[model samples]
Target: GGGSSSGGGGSSSGGGASAPAPGPQQPSRPAPGPAPAPAPAPAPAPSGNAAQVAISFAKAQLGESYILGGAGPNVWDCSGLVMMAYGAAGIDVGSHSVSSQYNTMQARGRLVPFSQRQAGDIIFWNDGSGFYHDAISLGGNTIIAAPKPGDVVKIQGLWGGSDIMPYVGRPG
Candidate 1:
């Protein structure tokens, strides 16, 4: 009877020992100490004004070819150019879709009428289907965009059309 009781206690103690040991070990091990290494990732992240950085990066891609879904480094589409430009500035809108990009701006920034838009504002246009084109404003009524499938990234005058309700979004 005594042996049975001691065996039960020993079994429970053995299990409890491993469980608590691992729990403390996880926190005590160097695992958390090396966590500081990944902190540098956010350190080198884009730190300046988002619009300025985005505009600078977008302008640098002036001659890149336009592809329907390209995301830069050479080629880009309308929304892809906008996304990559902002991403380079450390403001990720998290998508390649024009509508989704617009939503991100709507959530993070304020809408500015076309008449009051400034350089670096994100301007949007309808692609016949709806508001499906995006560009980086260069102010003075010009914009940097990938245009269309056969075009290259270039600065062009903003389109004036009532059919397309063009709008501007200022980054935060």
Candidate 2:
């Protein structure tokens, strides 16, 4: 006689069943803020030789979308950006990782100091962590970087963090 149509007098997990969710479910935490953006690609400051090709490439893609490993008219990563930029300028320099690019140029005495950074130079930063971040020094303390996902190629201060730049590897 006391039968009820509402769940047939049974409990429902939909706000009615009082069963807490499984194990220590941590409260929703926001994704950590993305690392600082990279500097913009600098204009040709030296002899203005073929460096303008890189400058033109970077300038043309000022707002292109940035995907971690993307390399195209739509998306690009830090290294991919550099590879494409120089490639557009007819330079054959190509590197997959930030460190590899750095090492490759380092062995050739292309690495330069931040003070001597010129347009088209590749800057790599190690935040004391194992991973590294990179950007193209467009001179004037501005660098071109593809940052992380959801971030497009943009210009920001050369340094992403407290790292004042320990070294820079110039891409010829």
Best by lDDT: 1
The global C-alpha lDDT for each of the candidates, from Candidate 1 onward, is 0.75, 0.72
Worst 10 residues of 2 by lDDT: 41-50
Top of the candidates by TM-score: 1
lDDT per residue, candidate 2, 16-64, as tens digits? Answer: 5357667987789777887678965443234255566886787788888
TM-score list, all predictions: 0.67, 0.66
Runs of candidate 1 with Cα error greater than 4 angstroms are 1-48, 163-166
Error of 2 at 88 (Å): 1.4
RMSD in order of candidates: 12.8, 18.6
lDDT of 1 by residue, 20-69 (tens): 44444454446544554432223122223887888888889988899998
